[model samples]
Target: MEIFLQQLINGVTLGSIYGLIAIGYTMVFGIIGMVNFAHGDVFMVSTFIALIAFLALTQILGATSLPFCFIAVLIGAMVLTSLWSYMIERLAYRRLRGSFRLAPLISAIGMSIFLSNLVYVLQGPRNKSMPPLFNDVIQVTQGGGYDVTLSVKQILIVAVTALLLAGFWLLVQKTSLGRAQRACEQDSRMAALLGIDVDRTISLTFVIGAALAAVAGVLYMLYYGVVNSSDGFIPGVKAFTAAVLGGIGSLPGAVLGGLLIGLIETFWSAYFSSDYKDVAAFSILAVTLIFMPSGLFGRPDVEKV
Candidate 1:
């Protein structure tokens, strides 16, 4: 039970990160009805940007305060990643719009390859390590030769996830921009006919999705203390799995799915075999997809002929 609790705590922290990235996947798919094959690469790029920002803050400017350095890196990465996201939409995706669906998908996959290789070329296919932040751990309980511990980083992850989720819900649910996005999601042609600016809404969607991915990237780097050019694929796929499992078009469902995937991976690693943890997650994803294609919160779309 102690180990269970410990794994649960760790799972929630990891799940929060997955939830952050999964929200990006869900948001993009919800609005555009396309799986962003390059979304994960965008996340990888943001992490590199965050790493560089941290170096600039700590090494160049001698920022010794962990909190200040973290804040600056997070904000800097968010801004730059949003710009990257915007450029991607404009350069790679915008022209493909209104074309055959496969055209955009192929473009997204090509962009993903381009980004991974671009980073590999620039940063040289090596793992970049950052100074560890939030090393403090508190033992919540001591039991039969096993101790349950909670780290400061875990607290920060959970808290930040909660805050971001709340802020985003407000943004999507209560704002005029959100209404416009919703309208576009429902019907882009009608949205444009109603003067909602479909193109701008799509761009904003990409920007917002990238900003969220930036947050996930920063937090992921902080948690792991190391990153590589190829770091985006697994997490990105897992996040997509989370989006699909929870209902690709549902925000709340994405969060739920992330949490479940995290828990499943952690518990399987703790109780069973670590090597098969990913297999378990993938198996669940496959099973869910086969059995419940619409997902828990997703509804099928039926268009009139």
Candidate 2:
């Protein structure tokens, strides 16, 4: 029971990171019906951006407040990463929108490769490490010769994720922009006909997705204390799996899927072989695809006559 409790805390913390990235995947798919394969790399870029911002804050500006530095880095990463994704949408995806389906997919793959290689060339293939923060812990329970504890970082990750999700939900449900996004998701042509500016809506969708991914990147760096140029692929793939498992077009489903994946990986490593943790998570994806293709919250597509 103690082991289970400890793994649960770790799983939820990891899952929060995956959930944030998964939101990006679901949002892009919901709006344009294309997986932004470059999203994970966008996340990778955000981490580097955060790293640079942190260095500038500490080394260059001599900032003492960790909280202020973290906030500045988070905002900087979000704004810059959003700009990067907006440009990617314009340069790589926008023109391919009307082309064949595979065209955009291939373009996304190419962009992913380009991003990974670009980061490798610029940042090198080595892992970048940071001084750890928020190391304090709260003892949850003591029993059965074991102590279950929760770290401050875990608390912050969960709290921030909840707040972001609430704000994002409100953005999607109660605003004119949300209405426009919904209209685009239903029918871009119809939305355009109604003077909705489909192009701008799509661009904003990419921007929003990238911004969320940026938050995930920052949180991930804080949790793990290290990052690499190639870090994006695995997490990106896992988040993509989460998106698919939860029903790609459903926002809440994406988050739920993320939590499930996180818990599965953590527990599998705790009880089973750690070498197969990735396998365990992927197995869930495969099973979901085989039995529940529409996912837990996703609606099946209805063909228009």
Candidate 3:
């Protein structure tokens, strides 16, 4: 039971991180009706940015205040990745906005390929390790004498995720900008008719989503202490699945979806075998799709043709 609880906590922490990335995907799809395939690569880029910043700062500042340094690097990566997302929208996707849906999908794929190749050329497909930001571990002794261990980094991940999710909830539920976003998602034409800047809203959606992805990247690197240029691929796919699991456009759904996936993966690995983890995950995905095609939180999208 203690082991189960420990695993569940671990799963929740990991799931929250995945939820962050999944929110980015779902937000873009909800508002723009296109999947940004390059998003995962954007995550990879941000992680590299944080890793570089950490290394450089450590060399210059001697790594005394590791927490502050980590926060600063994460913030910088978020801003840069946000800008990159905006650029992707402007350079690649904006042109195909009102065209056939396939147009933007192709553009997304092309951007994904471009980012991957660009990273490979620049970073040379090497796996880079980042120093762990915190070394402190938390241990809890259960009534039955089982020791439960938790890393400071894991706690940080969960805390930061919760804070960010709260902020996101406020942004989406209370802010005027979020209303515009929701309006755009529901009906771009109607949003435009009502004087909303649909294009700018879409760009902002990309920026916000990318920023969250960057945060996820930082947490991921800190959690694993290593990152590769191709690291985002599997996680990205899983995040997308989470997005679909929770409800493609629903914010709460994304979180729920991510946590569910994380739990499933962790339990499968623990009980069965790591070798079959992926198979188990995809099998669950297939079952979910077969039974609940609209996802647990997804409402049927009504289209006016």
Candidate 4:
């Protein structure tokens, strides 16, 4: 039972990260109907940004205050990445609007390849080691000291996830901007007729999604302690799966899906064989499609011919 509980906690932590990235993918898909193949690479860029910030801070400040350095790195990464998100939308995605659906998707794929190659050229093809932001010791007193441990990385993951979730909830539930966003998603033409700027709302959606991706990226780097340019692919695909599993376009769905996937992956690895983890997740997904294609919270769209 103790082992089960430990695995459960591990699953939730990992799931939260997946959920964060998934929300971005889902939101973009919901609002703009774009899959954003490059979303994962955006997370990769954020990780590199955080790493670069830490290195620069340590060099200039002599590493006197490690905690302060962490805060600075996170803040710097968020700011620049948020800007990067805005720019990508403005420069690339914005142009493809109203074009053939395949056009945007192909463009997104092109962007992904371009960004990955750019990072490879700039940082080299090898994985880079991330600096430790949390050095505190956490000793679990349960399970007979099976040597269970926690660290600042876990706390950062949870705290940052919580902050982003709360902010998202407030944005969707309480803000006029969010209302405009929902209007756009429900029907772009109607939203445009209602005086909402569809283009601007779409832009905001990408910015918010990218910013969340950046946050997830930073957390991932802290958790794993290393990152490579190709890091985003699997997680990005998994996050998209989580979004669909929870119910595409549903805010709460993203969170629920993320946690569920996280738990399944962790426990499957712990109790079963690690090699079967992907198989288990995909199997569940296939079953879900067969049994509940709309997902846990997805609402069906009705169209009149």
Clashing pairs in 1: none
Query: What are the C-alpha RMSDs, in order, of all predicted structures?
Result: 1.2, 1.1, 1.7, 2.0
- Error in Å for residue 235 of model 3: 0.5
Cα displacement (angstroms), candidate 2, residue 274, comes to: 1.1
Candidate 3 residues 166-263, lDDT tens each?
A: 99899988999999999999889999999999999999999999999999989988898898877867888888888889988888998999999988
TM-score of each: 0.97, 0.98, 0.95, 0.92
> Which lDDT value does model 2 have at 103?
92
Residue 115, candidate 2: alpha-carbon lDDT: 91
lDDT of 4 by residue, 63-138 (tens): 7687787678777887888787788788778989889989888988888888888899999999899656576858
Indicate which candidate wins on lDDT.
Answer: 2
Q: Model 3 Cα displacement at 21 (Å)?
A: 0.2
Off by over 4 Å in 1: 303-305
lDDT of 2 by residue, 144-200 (tens): 699999999999989988988899999999999989998999889999999999999
TM-score of 1: 0.97
lDDT of 4 at 298: 79
lDDT of 1 by residue, 95-162 (tens): 88879879888999999999999999999988999888899999999768799999999998888889
Clashes of 3: 0
Q: Please identify which of the two predictions, 2 or 4, would achieve the higher lDDT against the true structure.
A: 2
Clashing pairs in 4: none
* Of candidates 4 and 1, the better by TM-score: 1
Q: Local error of candidate 1 at 105, Å?
A: 1.1
